[model samples]
Target: MTDSVYVHMAEYLANPGIIGLAQSPGDLVITEFMANPAAVLDSDGEYVEFYNNTGSAIDINGFTLRDDGTNSHTISN
Candidate 1:
């Protein structure tokens, strides 16, 4: 079987207003990615795109991404 990742919205952090988040499986999807680009540097080339399957727009603030190695990142805005 294949592995799958799930995305969930957070309802915390001085949220001034209601921001929709992934409520269940399949609520978010990796729509596109670019591991390598013809030009530009790796920082400007490698990328991943996510799509919201829900009706409302979801806020990705406070989200975190990491790998088995020392690579990690968090969305602050």
Candidate 2:
């Protein structure tokens, strides 16, 4: 994604309340991130788990994952 988009996302993720979407009650939470494993290489074993504390399902089609400000992977449906 472009730098502007990255900045926007970073801002949103950092404080959803800026747009009035606070994390109170329920929200998608990153519960775990496994970076190493005995059964596989770290690259292959790495995984992130998210939990939707809300009662309904969440649509994460355009969500993005970034390890740093300059790089990102967008989730595609």
Candidate 3:
């Protein structure tokens, strides 16, 4: 990883209504993110997909994933 990151929004937030794959630096990338509303459920499931958009492999050993902005859960690399 060159300390760069990429973030692709789900189809719901686009003009054409489709997911986009934008690549960026890993250092500036966000560890935790969300999928489009269509793919993400509302308080139904207790799990979310944390995509590694670094364009390379990433090790998320001590990372945190939160849905309600308060309670956070950790995932292994």
**Candidate whose lDDT is highest:** 1
Q: Is candidate 1 or candidate 3 better by TM-score?
A: 1
lDDT for 43 in candidate 2 is: 65
Model 2 lDDT per residue over 1-76, tens place: 5222221244457556553232454477777765447788546876668787776665565567765356566666
User: lDDT (CA) for every model shown?
Assistant: 0.62, 0.57, 0.42
Which of the two candidates, 2 or 3, achieves a greater TM-score against the reference? 2
Runs in model 1 lying further than 4 Å from the true structure: 1-19, 36-40
Per model, how many backbone clashes are there? 0, 0, 8
Residue lDDT tens for model 1, 1-77: 54333332345344445547665667777787654487976667777689889888877876765544456556677
Ranking of candidates on lDDT, top first: 1, 2, 3
lDDT of 3 by residue, 1-77 (tens): 22222333333234332223333444225544443346555744433545565455544444444443345555554
Candidate 3 achieves a global lDDT of 0.42
How do these models rank on TM-score, best leading? 1, 2, 3
lDDT of 3 at 59: 45
Q: Is candidate 1 or candidate 3 better by lDDT?
A: 1
Tell me, by TM-score, which candidate is best.
Answer: 1
